[model samples]
Target: MASAPQAQGLPLFYNDLQPLSSDLHANYKIRRAETAPFLAKQHAVPLTVEEFPLVQRYLPIVFSMGDEPVPLGLMGLNEGINVFFDADGKFRENEPFYIPAYIRRYPYMLARLRPDAEELSLCFDPTSDSIGDFEEGEALFEDGKPSELVQQVLKFNEDFEIAGQKTNAFMKELKELGLLMDGEVSIQPDGAAQPYIYRGFQMIDENKLNEMRGDQLRKIVQNGMLPLIYAHLFSLNLMREIFGRQMQQGAVAQQEQPAA
Candidate 1:
């Protein structure tokens, strides 16, 4: 989803967006994805704050770098690497991995039709193999109306949009409080001359949080922002685990190279 852009300025995993209309796509059928090959090489997946508790157990929750930083769940530490998913984007055997909702909502999203559009329309990627005029799969429409599956998909997307709002609010608070700082993680393997240092991300500054005045700290804690921040901090411990996974999967080479 992160590599090889198909459409200019499009969201991850989307090549082209078309409104889901019964008139236009009445014959379309939605095929569930058995393997999301697009995600095979993606190292980071966007995450909503609502998923912090569950996702922290599987992926390191860190904020992305740049002006508009968003939460990202690290499937691997470096670019073009994923530990839990195979090359075909299927979960590894016997491994209980938590799939982010962002990945699950791929090929379908709510987008504004025009620059000044007030409401978002339900849209799907035309290039995706998951939805189209297929002989098999669930029907998207029934008798010129949206089917049950369509209803469910819309509901899920709506919930995702709400979660995105909450995540944005959480990020705004963090930024306003100056609690985020450039993130770095270093891993030193046995007998290695130099440690592999991973950088180019943002993270919560614990010192800043600890040094905050009582009123400021109480505000975040009362607003339920503290737990998500702690969840992100706790999840940082998984960086070592992910590095070890990359080693086991042969994703990291023996030669010392900086990870960006």
Candidate 2:
């Protein structure tokens, strides 16, 4: 669900990558996306700690299941199911949903040019129609130099990279403290005979959180990490909301099936 082939694993929504340069893409223009076809089938997206408060209000924030767990914003409880968006990647309802910066930064990201490269380079997905030679759109370069728009885009990606670093640090702390645990959520519709159980994800263990030493709790609070943790915990209720939406969209039927 992430990206196309690359020597280093590419992030989400990119089919191909090429370093942005005045020499190679001098005539290129960055166009605004009318619809995100790449996001149509993506149910979950990588999330940074910075977005926790805002993202919590709409999507259930959970951690991906693995030895190295990363935060994810759930668009749907199950794979290949995105209730918030339609087949064209447009919002299904008039109610606003917080679009994660990870999604907004699609087609462009900072990546190492080589495995041993010390510095990251501004690279873009060449397959994206958003960045290409076009008669109408914001110019990527002016007078053989990067335009103001390109600089702004670069700044956004740089900020995202910083946020990613913070997220990694946060995850490391959680792991060290032994806070995250395999998560499971079960929902039983009013008339359903069996409850649909969702699993294969990670979440903060509330039992462990409640039993933490005062000093450990204070450390996270002092660093403003407490609220972010709560945001993720509070957002878990939205799983049922998303499930309801799936039913309304006909993605889920009356029949019981395992959800993972």
Candidate 3:
């Protein structure tokens, strides 16, 4: 998953915001997100439907463990175990984890100007250290107008919102087609007596997907959903990899713990 725009609640570190004004934000700037403590979770993060292919290579594409079934890119096999990120809540130097667009678009998001307003306004998380006056990074405004960097962020947010809408529509199709089902994965550690059983998530049921009639299948194919489904299927194989990494991480942690 290359995004998390549809999470049930607000993303981590984004408490609330005040409107970004040229007058009020003349000196605000944001550093590169790569090293920022932007994400603290090792759990699966939201992913737009379109991002499945890109992230499927190294991450498992699964739905949220909750009833509301949203697509997620698994950074770890279980909660509190994002193997890709290091202890400092940062991606390992040169590790090349595919950073989600959700994380990249931090501190800035589109929101309604008012409760009943039909229009959206660009807003910023004023509390973010990534924002605020900084002489070293790209500025939000210049000469009381939005700077080029601000314009770029606005465009990215706009496109992300559009993609989010498409993702919602895709999810609706999945629900209507009865393609979603409970997820499970079983793994046996070497020399272990029992296999670890994993569940509590939603996934595409291959059986049901294959049972669709010719017309229904054709409809989805024409809608360009077949590849996305295949990407998901292929990505599921990475679940075992995530589990193995978790085990490795466990061992590393144990070794690093100081003696009592």
Candidate 4:
């Protein structure tokens, strides 16, 4: 298994409006892998005693086209993980983080370019109990109408490669802009042949980050963080704009504020 720090080095990180030294990139990757899982477990389903080891052993690879292994941290493989916010934090999970469009298309891509591999599976954590259903919030990338949010994220990832960026700086920008949000993943255990839910960090709002100030935000923008941050920001902004507009129009007058 790759050590946490070793794994992070594979992904590039931007800093000071320029990509950071290779050494710094390595540090961020390790940090992400070590920290992300703890966050995922917060929103994941509770693991039964028997399932603990499987959950612990499996680590999640946060998806980003720019960074080969975008380590958004780690998550348990089984149910009972979740996302949380410190009392002083600025964001909250208003809704479950839906799977991205690119991920949905991966199964087909794998089938078309079948490779000799030991094993392959899609690991995710679903926020809602209705794990079997993907009717709503399903992202389909076809006919040039890929999920708008995902498209933006992919672009941001590409920029990271073009410009060279660092990881910690990118995350700092994400937090400052409020683009990062709680996310969920559903994983299929090695032998069970069944899918299970686990929770983790995800990109929610995009535009809110536009309000952020200072060179820190600029550094993140210059780095590859643009794609992930923008995707999350757009998603959250879209939801809020739609819902907020609906409420103003009296579409759902009795709705209550989301729980923190």
- Against the true structure, whose lDDT is highest? 1
Tens digits of per-residue lDDT for model 2, 163-247: 9999999999999989999889989999887998888788999999999999999999998888999999999999999899899
Pick the winner on TM-score between candidates 2 and 4.
Answer: 2
**Candidate 1 steric clashes:** 0
lDDT per model vs. reference: 0.88, 0.86, 0.77, 0.32
Clashes of 2: 0
Query: Number of clashes in every candidate structure?
Result: 0, 0, 2, 36
lDDT pick, better of 1 and 4: 1
Residue 47 C-alpha lDDT in model 3: 79
Model 1 agreement with the true structure over 128-166: per-residue lDDT tens digits: 889999999999999999999999999999999999999
Full ranking by lDDT: 1, 2, 3, 4
lDDT of 4: 0.32
In model 3, the runs with Cα more than 4 Å from the true position are: 1-9, 65-67, 93-95, 251-260
Candidate 4 lDDT by residue in tens digits, 185-216: 34333453444433333534434566656775
Where does the lowest 10-residue lDDT sum fall in candidate 2?
Answer: 1-10
TM-score of every model versus the real structure: 0.94, 0.94, 0.89, 0.23
